[model samples]
Target: MLEDVFRDQWGRVLATLVGILGDIELAEDAAQEAFALASERWPRDGEPDNPTAWLITTARNRAIDRLRRDRTLARKTEQMGRELRDRPEDTMDDTTKLPDERLELLFACCHPALALEAQVALTLRTLGGLSTDDVAAAFLVPFETMSKRLSRAKRKIRAAGIPFAVPPAHVLPERLDAVLAVIYLVFNQGWGAGRVDLATEAIRLGQVLATLMPDESEVLALLALMLLNDSRRHARMRDDEIVLLDDQDRSLWNEQQIADGRSLLERATALRGSGPYVLQAAIADLHIRQPRDWEQIALLYGELGRITRSPVVELNRAIAVGEIAGPDAALELLEALDLGDYRYFHSTRADVLRRLGRDDEARLAYGRALELTAAGPEQRFLAMRVAELLPPGDRE
Candidate 1:
């Protein structure tokens, strides 16, 4: 119950307070205090009739007190008062208002002035509705480290006088990629890491971006990419074990999300030139479509490689190449690609070698993959793949 409430109301609480405080750092602190209050009161008073409004009201009241307590908070308090007085009462429950607020928050957190890591941390912290602990856990870092990173990021945002509003019209296009990347990481944190709520948080951001930047084809493309990949969440795991794409049960795929992704991708492509996201969406589209075939999918991966010019794209391309061109052909490309630094590079190459009757080479690749990888789910999965390659009669 608490989890659901936090997921849905946390963003609103932060948004409302940020609007009032006009300071991201102070607003976040105020929001945290409001949650602390909820933790203490909810079990006793029971959930509020209008939980969101209750949270907003509670946050506003708390901000008022905070402002009084600290001389530095006075400007924010007056700003909040003006904003509250000028807006309609319905603004408290306004869906439109929240999206715009979040959009602003997203852009602010991902401002180019900050380092990439700081941008990711701030986006996950402010917009993800995630705690410092959760952020630390996601990156497998210590709590203190995550907290310091966030604190440093907040300081930089304030010091640099980063604009809280979205970039100007002429600069929006230039900033769109970073914004999309921030959103993409949010979705990955949730969907890729099995944090469903975080994934939902990411989708919500994408939806807001799509609505706010309707004419920006890439924005719509990002939404399509997230929905397409997210639609497979059901079949991605079973009994705490991960399921590879080819092995997943197609029936578990959500038809609605797939249709939504396809529509968005089609529109995005027709409106503008293809981008890394649009290409990725196209790759996912091929995977989800009925009567799935490896050949057509391989070609999409190739296109994705061209669009992104990323080694990661090349790594994925190797997988498709393994399927259509045979392991020998794939091996030729994979061996030459300088992806050994990446964990999946060795793991994927191992899989290709295993399929090509090169047992010793496969084992060597898996060993290198294991050595390079951090111990995690992906590492364990790679280890299992290694075990599968052992001589059947000699295997346990």
Candidate 2:
């Protein structure tokens, strides 16, 4: 019960506190304290009728109390406490009356002033309701590193006075790109890690973004892309093994989600959105078809790679290229790009090498990939590949 409520309300409570306190760190502290108190008391007290209002009041009061009593608090926080004390918000009981400031909070987290990594980490910690540890796992960084990064990001926001409000229409497009990137990064991390909670959270946030920016083509396209990719989740793994896309059971795929994603893609196309996300969504749409269009997929990937100049995109293009022009072409493309420390690069190269009858090289590539892979399914799959490349006696 507590976990569910925390997931549902943490963002709202934190956003409201940020609006009131004018400090991300302070807001987070207060929100956490409130939740902690809730955890302690909810079972005994039988959960509040209006949990949002209760949490907001509790967190705000806790922050204000600290600011007033803790002489060590900075003058800025002291001044904030004074201003909050003067406000009539103490008596505001209805959550419906409060403004939903998550959009503002999200935009601030994704502000161009911050580094892209910081933007992603901050947004996940705050708006996505992920723990700092959760963010670190998604980033494949140490907990200490993620903690320091979050601290630096919050300090930067405070030091630079990045406004906690959404940008105006004139600059919204440029700012929107960073927000989209952060959201997609979160989605991909969850998708790759097999954490459905994270993917579901990303889709939920995307839905909110779509509702807010109804006509934004890329926003629609991104949500469509995620849904389309997520539709195959049930079929992507089997008994601790990674199932290849072609080998996945189509019966396990979510037909409704596919339909919804296709509908969104059509809308994005109708809007004439040829942006990176739209292009990718179009590719995802093609991917789910009975006979995968490797040629068109390669062409779309080439276009995506040109726009982003990302080696990962090039790597994907190479996979489609392999289907069209054989292992030699894919191997040639892979060799030209430098994707250091990327697990999939080694795994893909291993597959291409194996297809070319280069067992020795494929075994070496699989071993490297296995060392880098952390996910249970992928790790097992890579290990199996390595064993397959060995002679029967050597395998034993």
Candidate 3:
């Protein structure tokens, strides 16, 4: 009950604090204190009728106290004090709704002055209401390393005077890519790591993005792409084992998301959008269609590969090529790319090898994949592959 409200309202609460406090680090501290207070009091005093408004009131008071105590920010403290008195937003109940300032938070977090990784990290922290440890898990980095990175990012944002507001329309596109990349990375982390909360949060953020930038083709397409992929969430795993797309039960997929994604894709296409996101959305749409069109998907992946030149995109292209051409063609293409230690490359290679009757090589590829994989379902699936290929006596 309380947990759900915290998850849903944390961003709104924090965003409002950031706007009023005009400092990311300070606003975060205040928001955390406010939530902590809620956790302690809510269970005893009963839940507030307006949790968001209650939270905003508590957090703003804390921020005000901090600012008033700081001689360096005396002017800001006075100004904030006056604004608080004039508007009395902190006193609102059911009559007023908190402004969804998370868009401003996202843009501020993704300011170009900061490093790309910092942008992603900061957005997840504030917008997604993730703690530093959770952000570390998402990035697969050491806790201390992530802590330092986040601290540095916040300090940098302060030092650079990045505004907690959306950029002007003329400069919006330049920063749009960073914002989208941050959101998509959050979604992928959640999807791949089986964190449905994060995935759902990412989808929520995408919906907000679409509402804010209604005519932005890439924004719509990115939302479409995420929705299309996430529609299979329920069917992607079964009994703690990864389920391949070809084996998934269609009934388990979310039809509503599929319809929503297809509609968005159509909207993007109508706007003459052929960008990477639009292209990816188109390919995703093709995949969900019955009697799947492997050729068109392959061509779209080819174009996506050309534009992004990402090895992962090329790998996906090889998969579509494998479906259309054969395992041999896929293997040939896969072998040419330098994928480094990507787990998917080994797993895909192993599947290709298994198909070609190269049992020994396939086992080795599967072993490499197992070494790289940490997720339970994927590890089980890869181990199952290896176990089936082993000689009867050699099996564990």
Candidate 4:
């Protein structure tokens, strides 16, 4: 129970402290101190009826004490002290205020001035409530490297005086894409690495964004896209192996989530949103149907590709084109793409070559994909294909 509460409320507590104290390091320290106090006192004093409120009050008090102890720090934190002094008596009692601060923290972490990698790491640490070690593991970076990166990002935020608030409406559209990209990256990491907790955290962040920016069509579409994709989580793998989408057990898909995603997509479309997310959600919607319209999927991918000019989108479109125009056409289209380092591109090429009875080329493509991919299930699948393509005498 305590762990669950901490997981859910840690970001809120940290966000509120950062907003009030205007110091990321100070806020983190105070929040950690508050949690440490909770671990000791909650067991003895009985857990507070409102654990979140209790945490905020405790962390705020800790920050005040620390500020007072350091005379030099006192001058620097004067504004923070004043803000705390003037805060409404019931402010700590109101849990809703924490989420508002979390939104502010999200925007601050995703500030355009910060490097994109720093923005992603900082957001995952601060807003996603992930430990530095966890963030490092998620991104496949060394712990010390991630820690230094996070420290640098926080220092930059403080030195640059980046406001802890969402961007103004006029500037939001420009800034919003970075924030959404960070969230989507987080979701994609979870999806690719088979981490359910990370995926859920990303979805939670999406919901928060949707609630904060209800009228933003792209925000709605992003949430819809995540829900639609996550609906297949159960069917994505079996026996610790990757299951192809077509072979997945349809009964395992989350129907409720699919329904919610469809409704959200409808809302986005009603808003005349033809953004990449809305288009992707529309494609995912088609995928859930019994007989997917490959031509329509290909068209939507083309639209998305035209808008974003992403090679990845074009690669996906080629797969859809294969469904509509046969493997040869798909292979021809794919050969025009420059995704030499992308494992999936090679994997797709291998599939198309095998379909066209080009065993030698299929074997080579499968080998390239196997060499590029680190995923165990994907490597297994590719190796199986390579073996199947080899001559009977070379089966060993």
Backbone N/Cα/C clashes per model: 0, 0, 0, 0
Sorted on lDDT, highest at the top, how do the candidates line up?
A: 2, 4, 3, 1
The sequence of per-residue lDDT tens digits that candidate 2 reaches over residues 299-388 is 999999999999999999999999999999999999998996998999999999999999999988888888898867778878888888
lDDT of each: 0.79, 0.89, 0.86, 0.88
Name the lDDT value of residue 341 in candidate 4.
97
The candidate, 2 or 3, that scores higher on TM-score is 3
Show model 4 residue runs off by greater than 4 Å: 79-83, 86-91, 96-99, 191-196, 392-396
TM-score of 3: 0.80
Clashing pairs in 1: none
Best by lDDT: 2
* Superior candidate under lDDT, 3 versus 4: 4
Alpha-carbon TM-score of each model against the true structure: 0.78, 0.78, 0.80, 0.90
Clashing pairs in 3: none
**Taking the tens digit of each residue's C-alpha lDDT, what string does model 4 give over 128-216?**
77889888887788899999999999999989998898889999887998899988888887653323366777888898788878888
Comparing candidate 3 with candidate 4, which one achieves the higher TM-score? 4
Can you tell me which runs of candidate 3 are displaced by over 4 Å? 29-66, 69-100, 131-149, 169-171, 191-196, 358-364, 367-376, 386-396
- Evaluate candidate 3 by giving its C-alpha RMSD to the native, one decimal: 4.0
Error of 2 at 359 (Å): 8.1
Report the poorest 10 consecutive residues by lDDT, candidate 1: 189-198
